[model samples]
Target: MTDDLIGKQIGGYAILGLIGRGGMAAVYRAHQVSMNRSVAVKVLPRQFIDDLTYMQRFNREVQIAAQLEHRSIVPVHDYGESDGQPYIVMRYMAGGSVDDMLNAGPLRLDQIVQICAQIAPALDYAHGKSVLHRDLKPSNILLDDIGDAYLTDFGIARILGEAPGSTITTDGAVGTPSYMSPEQAQGHPLDHRTDIYALGVSLFEMATARRPFEGDTPYGVAVMHVTTPPPSPRLYNESIPVSVEQVILKALNKRREDRYDSAAALAAALRTAVEAPQASPPPDPQPSAPPPIEIQPLAERPIPAPVYPAPSAPSLRQVPPASVPKRKRRPFRLNLWVGAMIGGVLGCALLTVVVGIGLLIVGTSTSEVGPGETPTATADVTPSAHARALVNETAAAVESATPRTPTRRATAITNTPVERSGPSGTVIFFAQRPITVDGAPVEAYNLYSL
Candidate 1:
């Protein structure tokens, strides 16, 4: 991990040479014996190897960082300890860091956009995993031989929901003061936006070739970040568009809340502003109405009455009218009166049968000529013509069966079913002189019947 490890072997990786050394860790180009591929090896400094608390946290954070799999993020190959030192192996990027590029010359606007495009989404992906790259700067963005960029050094990033460890100490400021967010400078609680603010500072530096705020010491610089507003990037680079300047300032806003919510958003804003600097400002919050049309006043131009189309003259049909369908004739049916007559004939036959049956029943009975025998009627029970006619008329009424009106009639003087309670005796009356009943006339009657 130190300078002496140039020719030494640590955990099957042969240290080729030191790549760079930051405050947290030292990166070295190493040869992987098992895979036979060149890889970048990042080792923890010896100063932190003795601190057991930091060692445990470092391993935990690196393990989480290894789980990240993204095209833009530098993929972790392996991580383990050699003796008392922990080291992480990752893809070896050949094309130096943006730090080197900046040191050589000012970056082109398109180059800055291209680099941001690659890293912004990677930062957002880390944030989604609740891992914040507390240290996001030019030095951490690695480029390849072809100028393609990738985000690296994620092993030193702090987990969002966890407490501050030795990697990002809570007692003092966390990241480099040049790119540190205002909240990070003040040692305040941080969220994903802290990384966004640092990105803005980096953007300012890339555009202007200088940090937004500088002081005599790191503490002084951090305080300046907290207290002072960042000078415009255009102040150093007059060629920078105002829209691009606005995006940087917005990301570098003193309040974390005022910054972009996601790294992707910041990159997109920068891309849009830089690409379309001459484009019109965004439309107002309210919906845009159509351009107004001018109309002449009614006083100067009198309203013309609407003219209606003239009606065409009536004309005869071009073709003769289709012939109306003729109504079909129905077959003949029996008249209702004929049905009534047939019904009447049937009813008369039924009545004649009934009358004949009654007469036959009467004729069949023997006349005993006394009460001990039978009702010896002196007259024969013959079906008389008049009686037959009356029965036929009564049978006619059976068709409709309508109720009849009340009529008075004389009661026959024989065989009334009277209730007899006491003694029954015969009473004979001769011309109003024999027996008196009800204190009036003369009549013969059974006493019980009376």
Candidate 2:
């Protein structure tokens, strides 16, 4: 269908122009004539409404995001059908997206930390509610005018308590490959930690000004993510501290067990890294010169009889060398160093065998005890009940410690067609400069710059 609706009214709202479009839908900045308020309306493409699968997913995005209300999450104001098209009306955010900021290159450490502080909370809240955002990337995060972070596009978020492995089985490989976690890339079921992995990828990209893996094609990049270890972020910017590197690595761990157990853990570690003493960059290695080449002299040659004087000198020289050769010096001492070196090697081998036997005996004794070894007063042990209580307490602390972000306010709303750039690019809600609050004339269209 052509986007020729410059001044068409639907559901009492007038559509001005196209604001932005993605693979699934387009966002439009529109004016609600009845309420005299502006709003951002996301509508599914008309072509896919007939396809049951795409339609179901489109409906799911609205249903899932609409139920949750958070400052970081774009609030869905309404959901309905207009002229055979399903659309969602959400609060229009004016600040832009994180992806836009990252396009400028690596962000300062402080900026990265601040962004994480804002997004981590949203992730934690979603996880708490048993929702896993299968797609968590910079493009999906928005920053308001106050520089606060908000997560948008929960189209692929999976709500827990449905079925076993509901997260992956419900939808196969549904996220952008560059930011997908290894498990998600493999189409395996995911948990809270999976989102943590994607967030780590985003943080890495933010700090390095590039994605961890990139190739000729999306599939190639997906393979890299699954197989390659991320390059050191410090390589791009030496100012990145070691503590931050450790935090990033922990979250990017290939195995879920090795990653931060929860978003709060990652957020806490990030805060600590930010507060910890900064480390000095390592000194560059000194360049070395090429080695010198050895030279050899040509063998001496005897002169011909034609040179009478040269022949006499050669005869005298030969006489002196022969006299010296006759008196070959006897060796001052036998080569005893070789024998000493061999003796030392033998002694080391003997010592190694003795240590091996000792270690074997200790291992056997430990196994026989079957963890029943009594502890001396030096070793403190808790009773089974106390140990269980400690375990429960630790679990509760982990659950409680996950980080979350506070909600922020949006300055303007758009429901017309848009041109979405990287998420953080400056967004204009209207077609022209200076958005009108009294509702610009229905015919006076303004383009929103984002």
Candidate 3:
């Protein structure tokens, strides 16, 4: 299949080269002409296209993957069949798989936390959407350029709404032995917690650089998953904190009830354990001391009092005469005078303000009526009528004295000429003319404009 697909065009994607090969499918780096970008294309073998079971699983992978939209989940870009073969197009992850990273060496504690934090939420999202990643393992988890983990390859995932025994195979179990939970290994009904167990195994390997259980055969490994209890991660690396070990153990529990209810819950516990401070060792015990003596011998003789010579009197030159402080009579008189002056000034200012206000009112009232116009009101009319008469006279005088210019309708100049000096020459450009008032363009005068 890899040899035939190297130069073949599938759907709208032009196969550029092969990226990796798997048991069921071959991944290739393809150029999507529509998007003008590179993408990873997983092509299933042509033989499986005729098998209803394999076809259904391939379709399920497409449907389930298309629904999951998350930063930590590899996005499905396109899926279709071509030349009697099914293939799925996904984002190309440049950092390879987590399994590849583990092959080199064990991940650091910080790296483990970072990967789990991303993976847990992705599982939670899938579970919330009623999908289960039945075959979760390190290989299924891919990383990006910056080390962000993304869960991929949901080929064997079981939808929660499917009927019972729908996913059971003739051989019974369906997932990888080393990463399968007890329920999964025993062919029992699975749920989101099973994925949590698998994640636990992946995390254990990440922290300890080895799996918790190992066997000579796949069957033996599957059996150990159901029967054997996970060893403490600290056993592999004593530097692992105790809190982290407890978290891993809890996730690896045989019974789903004993484990975290959701992947998010497990992730929270992992983060807390990794970030928590290690417990300090107990202090060494102090030596026991004897009880104090109850009785002590009295002193043989009474202590004598020590005497010292008296201090000599200070000389007359050193002694300052005690003069009575003089009463500050001038300050008291000055404060009274200052207060009186301030009071007078304030009174004068108040009077000036009041006179100014009164003059302003008189001027405004007188100006309301022109000199030639006399406001006369009937005896039955109220003061409001008189004020209305004065307002009418003022408006009439204003209209008569002001010159009436010819009313010109504003015309929208769509292309007004604008000139600016540029490096090449004076650039003449056309723009929409702005609204103007009395031949003056409206200028922005607000604080923001200034």
Candidate 4:
């Protein structure tokens, strides 16, 4: 039945293609012929056309959505019935919904912040008008080509003045289980805080890329929303600042009163947390260690000079030649007393020799008694006592000076080569026997021929 709507004219709009489907309605891309502009047309499905319950809800969406006018709210342009099926025409969002962005991947912080800035205030504005968007989730929020956020789908919303204490549904819960507040999960009365809780869930998904609590069934997840405390946002995204996590926790508080007073307050707190400057780190308990001091190596240090004699000093003395060195000769010295005694002994000997000669001359002198007779010098060969003693001393000195001849002497015969014996056969032997003149033997050699 939805496919047959393709190329079909509905209220001066040509149907193009189906954009997406939801429990509330099916949205399609279409062109309004009168304005020559593109628009999003949401139509109630064929199965629910006969159901009064859905039909009335569809009609209520058309009425409420047209009343909202803001920069961040999707403007309702037209609404009409085409052949028993109700359809709503709204300004087409070229960038698609936040659900599409979540399906692709987690959103960036700047984009999420920018989006929240637009949508959060829009929600606050709606709440101020006594309008409560009971079903506020990612799918209900749309974005334009320039990343401008626009809140849509006021289908399950309530004009709070019409019914404040009554439940949005008569049979069961109305909002998404994962995003539902604790009171909404328990079927208790709800206020603007429910939407704030849902926005916290969407922020959680944008930061962590996953819902805080997950289960096999919607009832189980809803039970966790009511009973369990929200897990820390930093648990999923460690890069999230502690301040930002605190803001998320405050917005997701179980009790509605504990949460931010308004959606604008939540957005303001989030912005301040994100844009807030990082705090200065605490000072360390102990002082920093000192820089290391480098020590010189032993090999690089200069050696000290020797204590006794410096090794680097040069010698002053000159070196001699390699040949033998000559020794110095000392002058001779004689004693004066010894020289005098030697001179005295020589004088005595000379005097004795002179006197002996004089005595011999006197003894040999002839008396001149007869002049006529030729003076013949008839001399006695005898010396006076003094002279005789001198002659005796001289003889003794000469005898002692003579060298003694010995017997059995070896004589080298070089006179003739009689036996050709150079040092042996030509030798003679002489033995002496002294003829003593009554007492002493004389030193002589008597030769014996061989």
Q: What is the C-alpha RMSD of each candidate to the true structure, in Å?
A: 26.6, 58.7, 40.4, 23.0
Separately for all candidates shown, the number of backbone clashes (residues 3 or more apart, or on different chains) is: 0, 37, 0, 0
Instruction: Residues 1-450, candidate 1: write the lDDT tens digits.
Output: 338888999999999999998766789999999999999998988888987656655675577667788898888888888887899988899998998899966699999999999899998998999887888999989998788898876544677666555444444556788888888877788889999998888888889888999889988998899899889788899999888888889888888878889989889888989888766254225587899997888888878899998998877757878999998966444455664575566556554654564454444443323457544333443445654554445445442342222331223344333332221221111111132222222222211111
lDDT of 3 by residue, 1-450 (tens): 238877879999999887777757788989999999889999988767777777777787887888889888999988888877889999988889988898887899899988999999999999999888888888889988788999999888878877765653323577788899999999887888999999999999998789999989999999999998888788888988878888888889999998889888878887877776454211234576798866544665556699897998877677668999998754212244554564465446534643453454355546676778765422441224434444345434433433323432244544443443322121222233343333433211100000
Clashing pairs in 1: none
lDDT per residue as tens, model 4, 413-437 = 2232122111212222223323221
- TM-scores for all candidates: the values are 0.59, 0.59, 0.59, 0.60
TM value for model 2: 0.59
lDDT of each residue in 8-45, candidate 2, tens digit only: 76676788777678778888888877778877788888
Model 4, position 139, has a per-residue lDDT of: 82
> Candidate 2 or 4, higher lDDT?
4
What value of lDDT does candidate 3 attain over all alpha carbons? Answer: 0.74
- Flag regions of model 2 displaced more than 4 Å: 164-169, 278-450
Pick out the ten consecutive residues of candidate 1 with the lowest summed lDDT. 424-433
Q: How far is candidate 3 from the true structure (C-alpha RMSD, Å)?
A: 40.4
Candidate 3 — which residues are off by over 4 angstroms?
165-171, 278-450
Candidate 4 ranges with C-alpha deviation above 4 Å: 163-172, 277-450
Answer with 1 or 3, whichever has the higher lDDT.
Answer: 3
TM-score computed on alpha carbons, candidate 1 = 0.59
